[model samples]
Target chain A: MPSVKFIEHNGTEHVVDGTNGDSLMMIATSNLVPGIDADCGGECSCATCHVLVDASWVDKLAPATETEESMLDLNPDRESNSRLSCQIPMSDELDGIVINLPEFQY
Target chain B: MTNIVIIGGGQAAGQAVASLRQEGFEGKIDLIGEEPSLPYQRPPLSKAYLSGALEASKLLVRPEKFYQDRDVATHLGSPVKHISPQERTVTVGETEFSYDKLLIATGGRPRKLTLPGSDLSGIHYLRTLQDVDNIRAHMATAKNLCIVGGGYIGLEVASVAVTLGVTVNVLEMESRILQRVTTPFMSDFYHQLHTERGVHIHTETTCQGFRGQSGKVSHVLCGNQEIEADLVIVGIGIIPNIELAETAGLACDNGILVDDHCKTSDDNIFAAGDCTNHPNALLNRRLRLESVPNAMDQARTAATNMLGGDKTYATVPWFWSDQYDLKLQMLGFSQDADAAVLRGDPGTRQFAQFYLSEGKIIAVDAVNSPKEFMVAKQLHGVAVSPEDLANLDVDLKSLVPST
Candidate 1:
């Protein structure tokens, strides 16, 4: 199990145990971490699960699909490391990955 | 603190409440839903929830604690009887609630076929969770399921029923399945897919009525042909719930007419979700959409403008459907597209059909190709030749300029 840290826009942090094969959005949302509203249920169609990954771990994670990048493009607070958390599947290698929730997804 | 009343406890209303709180609005929020449950996600009602793959608790759009902690007054099972814009009050049963600003997110209701033998016990329409719960209970003993529409709901139910080892038959009034929404090529693909899965599809078939055994639906009567069925699911379409807005003297044309800000004829009254027909600057027309994304986006826009922010709703509409391991994602509208450029081979079950008009991309329907659909969504109004779009060798990502 990998431990992922999710930091909200208000600077609130939530550390949750990420099981292999589960999405980051799924882990945060199932664990009651605020700000990760996966309204589309891990579907890449909606950008509600957007997260700004820390630059240190950006290269370590899998590259975002064109669909994920398109959703991230819609985010008002999108950064270079912005990614839809649903596209990021959890794995042991991603243990200690830090992500920041945007102020708003729209 | 100003009082805001939002009608219909569905996606739009839920998003409105969250958007208001996120905007730091400390006001009274009264969420009135006709259903017994709190604001829940209806998309999964036909998929996971219908098949029992997902638990009832997972259907909740937000945790129950969020509403309580936010002080949202949720009136479940309480249907608003009337709305008086002059009095600025909404009447739910015997109670009347006053509001400084009101949002009409009443959404829409499933349209039913009005013909002989329409009233039967086993005939169902997919809308609320209670409706699906009823259908699921009947599915336990149901062996043959007759779907009266080839739309999303009807096809989704067919998918679930076939998976349950139930014989499925889809009756579509149109020439082909999904004719109203998708191109012929896309429709043919689905038609073949469903046929290969042991599901029978009847196209250009109009069901006149239903016959029942002991008041339970037993067979469907089409124009001279009778199709045997133990259960029937109707998914023809939905009619917008604009009675409240119409009664209030607000402009009503197909739906509650709202401005770009989502405000109705009455300044203090607004509407969102599938209930409101508003102008889409992006599509260059007025449209009413029934997708979850459309509801959420318009709700946030309505919330912002209600809070003194001068914002307009102009996002490209997108929709999706899941069936038998295939996800069909679409963006924009293909109403007037002159040509459809096929990307990738449909034989692999992973391809995209881009609708283009005079060389400018207008819309795309991607089957199990989320990446192509996402890229096409970003290039909504961009002019791209069909030649480049057809070539899979051309990286679609490079076509979109970095912001």
Candidate 2:
């Protein structure tokens, strides 16, 4: 199984195993990691499951679609590496992914 | 050690436990719910869960392990019978539990039709997981499905049932479908969309009663005409579960009245979710919204305030409804708007209805057009003319202050 690291805004870290079929939000949430709200349950509608990806691993992930971008644009704290974790599918390519969670979801 | 007790088993209950733990409360947290399972999201029940595209486990906001890992004791399958604010105690079943602070997240129940033959076996509602399971079971061999009240639940169920080869008849008491929440243009859009997909929408039709055979619903009688239906589903609206709070002497109107901080009449008790009629700081009015965003946001606020932090919930209300392939996203309420503009063409199945009050944008209904929705979200206090709104050629991102 691939592993993913979630770092909270306070610098607390939680490393969890990610399965191939589950999304990053599911992994973070199932591990009881704080900060990923997943309000819409991986529907790509609510951008609450936001994660700021590390700069080095930004291009390793798929680019966000227009719908996701539109959802993220509603967030005032969205950053350049901002992505809805629910939209990111877990795969072997994302084994050592580092994710930083925003301080507040809403 | 301090103890915190949360009532109800919906999104707010689950989020409260998570929020309390995240805030480092370290108190004895107990989440007692009427349902047998963990706190789950109800949004997908009408859409993906009804269509069997989403499973029951996926609806949970957090799994059981999270609650256990956080030392949050979950007592499921029992409803809180009484709340004694004087002692800060809640009674569930035969056991009485005391609390230092309490959260009433008791959601709402589907409003049921009290007409004749309403006790039939095949009649169903789509509120909980078991309700959908029952509806799906009835749809297995059932052909004609009569849906009462053409609201979000009724229409979303109609779209799913019709697509699954079930003949659907939607009976709305109003002159048009979704009359309460949307304009005629949006209603017409949905009417056309559902009609194209083989759904029989009967507007201005009232369901009189259900005629059944062998204690099973066979037809829905509407005034003089009776429509044959093997199964009947009612989606008129939801009555907030405020009875629990009312009996406990909390102020109740259409919903449990709460302040902007989610604080109820009692200082030791707070409320959130669909159960609370809360004041919106942004809108400058009180509203009882049945929305996931409100439930989640208010849960955070209530949790922070529970921990002695000053937090106020002033989020501009937003809601979404998924029917067929169209995702209807609405920001704020458009009822107070005097002028409305149709941004983009509805023929392309992508446009937004911008509603303005006093020549300033107040609310919007975006259909498959999320860019305009994002722009509309930031236009709460900004003043803009209707021409600026209708002009889609200009990038909507440029109209607002860039984040």
Candidate 3:
């Protein structure tokens, strides 16, 4: 059972169990995480399910696809580590992954 | 001690609960819905659910425990029969509940075409999970499927039906497919896409009546031409659910009239989603949009205003549709654009059409081009050189004037 830590903008943290093969967006949304609004329901169309991965854990995660990069590019607030959570799936090697919720899900 | 009542069970109602709790509203929340299932996304009903690729449980907008933990008293499978604005009470089924504030997120229903012999048993409208389930059951036996209206819903269903080895015939009353929502280029693009994939498209064909055998629809009579259809699905359009507001004496026109703040005629009541014709500050028009993004954004704004916050929902409207291997994403809507610019060749299966008015990007239609769609949302209403937009060498990011 892998786990993911979601840190809100206000410094509050939520550690929830993540099942293997489910996207990070599904895990955060299923657990009622407040900040990540997966409005498109895992469709890469809407970039609302945005999260900035922890700098230490950034390289450990799968790289964002070209489509995801294009979607993330237009955002004025997008950081270098910013990725749509829906594009990342959970895995055993990525256990205890730490991700930060952006101030707004634009 | 505060009581907030939300009427509707779609994404708007579901998101309203999340928004309310996140905004720190420590009060009683009641959500009354006509559907038995919790709030779910309707987009998948046409694509995945119809093709048996996705299950029924996956359609929910949020998990069930999310609402239960927040203590949202959801009255599923029951409609709000009456709303008394003066008393701030809504009658759900047999129970009467008083509210300090109320939200009418009652979305909309499919607009049915009433022609001769339309009461046939095989006729259906793609709106709910039950509708898709029933249609899927028919698809198992249906050989010739006829889809009325060549809009997004109709074309999406056609793609699925054709993929399932069922012969699909799309009948559109308009001169071209997707005429109501898109420009000629994109409509023609979809027309070619569907035809190339083995779909029979009948444009400018008006269905006059339906004829059935054994009480099930078997044929569609279009003027002098008759279309033989073993199964029929109508995707014409939708009618907003504004009867409650109208009965309660709220202002109504094309839809329940609301301001950018999602406030109705009565300050105590707010309306969101497809049911309300809200004014968009960016578009500067009062329009009723039937997109999931619009519904969620408006619901959040209404929740904030209901909790005494002064937030407004004026975000640029955007929508997406999937059919076969193509994904169409659109931002903004204007059919009366004086200038339409094309970026990339449509024959390449990846292109974008920009609709400009007064030299500003008013609307855009992007097919299989996510990069253009993403840039279009940020540059909505911004004036750009049409030459720069048509030039492929210049990066679209550069065209987006640096703020």
Best by DockQ: 3
Report the lDDT tens digits of candidate 1 across residue range A1-106: 7999999889998887877877888677656566866657666766778888999999998898766775665454678999989888899999999989888654
Best by lDDT: 3
Every candidate's lDDT: 0.86, 0.88, 0.89
Worst lDDT 10-window in candidate 2 chain B? B394-403
Clash count list over all predictions: 0, 0, 0
Question: After aligning candidate 1 to the native by TM-score, how far in Å is the CA of B144 from where it should be?
Answer: 0.5
Q: Is candidate 1 or candidate 2 better by lDDT?
A: 2
Candidates ranked by DockQ: 3, 2, 1
Q: On a 0 to 100 scale, what is the lDDT of residue B131 in model 1?
A: 94
Return the TM-score for candidate 1, rounded to 2 decimals: 0.90
* TM-score preference between candidates 1 and 2, better one: 2
Clashing pairs for model 3 are none
Q: What is each candidate's fraction of native interface contacts (fnat)?
A: 0.14, 0.54, 0.68
lDDT of 2: 0.88
TM-score of each: 0.90, 0.96, 0.96
Off by over 4 Å in 3: A30-32, B401-403
Better of 1 and 3 by lDDT: 3
Give the per-residue lDDT of model 2 (tens digit) for A1-106: 9999999999998989887968899889777688888776788876779899989889998899889988887677789999999989999999999999999874
